[model samples]
Target: MTDLTELGVAAIRDGVAAGSFTAVEVATAFNANVAAAQAALNAFIVATPDKALDAAAKTDKARAANKPLGKLGGVPIGMKDLFATAGTQTTAASHILEGFIPPYESTVSQKLWDAGAGMLGKLNLDQFAMGSSNETSYFGNVVSPWRRNDGGNASLAPGGSSGGSSSAVSARLCPAATGTDTGGSIRQPAAFTGISGIKPTYGRCSRWGIVAFASSLDQAGPMARDVRDCAIMLEAMAGFDAKDSTSLDMAVPAWEAGLSPDMRGKKVGIPREYRMDGMDADVAKSWDDGIAWLKDAGAEVVDINLPHTRYALPAYYIIAPAEASSNLARYDGVRYGLRDLPEGAGLQDMYAATRAAGFGAEVKRRILIGTYVLSAGFYDAYYTQAQKVRALIARDFEQAFQQCDVILAPTAPSAAFALGDKTADPLSMYLNDVFAVPASLAGLPAMSVPAGLNREGLPLGLQIIGRPFDEQGVLNAGLAIESRAGFTAKPERWW
Candidate 1:
């Protein structure tokens, strides 16, 4: 019998449909895995085993009675702490929101429950989803299960602010998990952990109850072991929500149906501008191999230039933090979350003390920078200019898409780095999002798929970017690459 903990959502659904497995049994297996993995990785802020089992029991009873099942049936999944879950602590891995439980669940989480997907728990993340590395999280950093290939040290980073989601999913704690992307949280961590994750077009998934970082750029997405599983999860996750003003009113495509191997007559663009100095040679080789595979599949590979790529990282830093500062202002003492008392302090003093005591260093630094950029004297010079640059970056993608159906590039400059390697230098941390920020700025749909491993045997990933609301193109392209890559699940040392 196949191990329930290792089966993908689609496979589990198939098993349940065929009477080969029961939903309760599947849930129990995954719950056990979560308990074992959480002790080592600290992946979750909360684990709702009782809730999951109850939901799974209902699914099993429905199956026995021949009642219709939802798409996800009884698959176990993890929610990033950013999404609000009714009656559960939605801390976003920050001390400020430590005790605040939402009276309502986010639309995405509700949708998953409605579809009969079982929730394992809320996963840890960078506080308010602000930082590129998981180390900035108030809960502590997540360590990758994959060790150093050089045999130097066993400890390594799992990437962030969705690091816990990726780490847990990659570690087999759950078959798949939901994640949010403001800058590159979903794709970066997927790349680092050797898994597949997709960030649909901006506003593809509603942001109603997700703890906001940058309202304009924030998106919720799916992370799984492979592309097809991500497609299944994305299908359940994407839709319009009246609650989120920016939610796009569009039809969610049949993402899994059109995954064809025949790429004949399709055009793929290779952006020349993504090749930066100091890029790892292994990543470059993987890029070459990916292009070769595309050619083998009969797709025309053409080199294109996104000249404005150089300005994307800077533009993102200014805009994301500016929005973050505004969104996070609600966390002051009186409204919700933690309150600091400075021994008979005044209102202003209490507010100041609360923030100083509750927020992590990176969160505070971002708030300061965000406030500065939006200040009267610097508003036009920084935030406004970055907005203009963001438009230009989008235009670059528009022009590139005019020539090709999809764009391919390295997901990150390198694989996961050691913990604390770049935390001290914020700029170096920001640079990790170099390849992903452009798509986020353009509101384009993008996905990361594990392509191959480097000489060091660490995993490498290739990113596929599609035109706005063109998630079908992204998924189809990812399917093509996944088939050729032949990458399979491997047991991590920590697992």
Candidate 2:
């Protein structure tokens, strides 16, 4: 039998349903792996092996009783810390949120539970999901399992916000994990860790319980080892939610059953704007390889222009932070999270002290930027202008999609950089999302598939952006890349 930890979500689902292996065994194996790697990887913010085993036991009992299992029955997964788990701590990797546990489960996590997925633990992420690198996590930076081909022992970052989710799935600590994408949070990290992840079109998944970053752009999705696994998990995670007004009111599409590697008649758009100055040679080559793979799968490649591409990053920074300032205002010490009340301090003094003490540097920076843009005089000049540019960016995609079914581009400008390398320069760090933010601003469905390795043996990912409600087309394209890329490279386990 193959390693239980190494199996994909679909395989695990089928195996548990067939009684070929008990769910308890699967949970136990992954629990041991998580325990062993916790120190080196720093992927999980908290370990919930007991919860996992309890869920697994229920799955095995269901099998014994000849009852139907849910879509994720007996499968274990990591919950991103941003999601509010009923009993577990749901910190968004920030001191402000530390020790805050929700009495209610997030809609997406609850759906996974109802579908039979076991909770392994809450995974780490950047504070308020702000940083490109995982270094800003309050717990500590998550170390990627991959090393450079030159055999340098330096630790690399698992691209952030969803860094821990990517690290755990790639290291085989869990079959799949939940991730929220506000601006490349899911896709960028998945690319860095050599896995598959998709950010469904905005409103496809409920935002009811996930911590808010940008109300308009945040979306929940699946991160898994392969496209099929991501498809299966996504079906269970997405659907209409009355609790969230943003959630679509339609039934979730059956993406798993409809998975196909055929792209014979599909038109894949190669955006001319993604070829930026100083793009890494390896990244360029991988994008070229992705084009060839899609062509081999029979997709007709067409060059399309998105004229507003340059404005996406600037617009996103402004809009996301503006929303962040509003959403995060509730964290003032008067409520549940950490409060810094000085002796005999007044309400205003306490609020200021708590925020100053609780928030990290990066989170503070974003909040300040957000507040400034939304300020009285500057609001029209900065925030309003950015919103207008955002509309233009969406229009650019709308126009481009007329000539093509989906767009293909590199997931990031370069491979995973060494930890601490980009921490000093905030601008450089923000550039990591250059290729990913455009689709995000447009509220489009996008996915990242591991394409191939760079010259120094780092993995490179190719992104596919699809039109609204076209996740099936996006997954189909990803499957085509997965079949051709044959990207089975794994980080050598030094831990």
Candidate 3:
């Protein structure tokens, strides 16, 4: 029998189908794992064990009766708190939304449930998804399961925004988890935790009911222990949702269908611009190894240039914050979520007091910057220019796609860093996402797969960027790299 903790979603489903394990048993094991890992990693804001077990029991009943089993079947997954779950506290890791419970579920969460996936509970995240390091969370920072290669007391950081999901998945608390990426939140955390994750093209997944940061940039995706599991969860999570105006009407593709090893004529691009200075030697080696693996897998590796890469980071920072300012304006004292009651305070004063007391420093910084950029005097200079630059960045990827099936680069500059290492310097923390932001700007599909381990014994991942709606290409390349890299064990101490 496959070890419940170690099995992927696909393996777990197969086991359930073959009567090797029941959904109730599988859910129980994962719930236990969540409790164990939560003490060390601080990954979850809530763990709904009773609800998960009940759902899993229903799945087991259906399977035993030879009734229809949904795509996800008995798989248990973690949800990022940003996605509203009915009756659950959806705080978004900020005090502003404390005790806020939605009456309805997010479209993505509903889809997962409809597909028979069990929810382990809401995971922690950077406050308002505003920071790159998990330290900004009001719930406390998430520690990476991986430690320094040399025996040390270094508390490693699992990357931010989706840090809890990444940490939980890496720690084997759940088979896979849901994450939202506005500007590299999902991919960066996946890279830091040494797991596999994918951010589908914008609109590929529904945004309805998910707390908004940047409406245009925010997208929900899956993070898992491996590429195939990521593929499995993504297939169930993506679909057309008429409720979300921006949701795409495109048919959800079979993400796992074309994952063949035959890459004989596939053209893979190595973007020359991503090779940044000061990149760690181990990361560089991992990139080279990934390219070698692709070439050995019969894919043609070619150098491609995305000339606008230099402008992407700046443009994304401007655009995402500008959108955030508008989206977060709903959090006044009169609205849903937390409200501050100050003695003798009028309407405006009450609103100010509530926001001041609720929002964290990083969230406030983003809102301030966002408001400043979108202000009348600065609008044309900052927000307008950033929009134009975003267009240019998209065009760069469009041109690159004509020459290659997918583009490859290092997922991050390095593996997980020590907690508190970059928290004091916000700019340094933002720089950590330099490599993963360009794709988000272009609204392209991208994924991170473990390529190799650094000298510190921490894992490094390679990113694969695909054309719009071309997730199959990205996953195929990732599967190929995954087979070659073959580094499948979690940190020994974590186990």
What is the C-alpha lDDT profile of model 2 across 1-495, one tens digit per residue?
779998989999999999899999999999999999999999999999999999999999999999999999999999999999998998899998899989999999999999999999999999989888899998999999999999799999999889999999999999999999999999999999999999999999999999999999999999999999999989999999999988899888889989999999999999999998888999999999999999999999999999999999999999999999999999997768999999999999999999999999999999999999999999999999999999999999999989999999999999999999999999999999999999999999999999988988888899999999999999999999999999999999999
Give lDDT tens digits, candidate 3, residues 57-90: 9899998799988888888889999999998889
For each candidate, the alpha-carbon lDDT, in order, equals 0.88, 0.95, 0.90
* Candidate 3 residue spans exceeding 4 A from truth: none
Model 1, 294-386: lDDT tens digits are: 888788999999999999999999999899899889988898899997887999998899999889998898899999999999999999999
Q: What is the TM-score of each candidate against the true structure?
A: 0.98, 0.99, 0.98
How high is the lDDT of residue 494 in model 3? Answer: 58
Rank the candidate models, highest lDDT first.
Answer: 2, 3, 1
Q: Indicate the residue-level lDDT of 115 in model 1.
A: 85
Model 2 ranges off by over 4 Å: none
Q: After superposition, how far is residue 35 of candidate 1 from its true place, in Å?
A: 1.1
State the lDDT at 267 in candidate 3: 97
Of 2 and 3, which scores higher on TM-score?
A: 2
Pitting candidate 2 against candidate 3, the one with the higher lDDT is 2
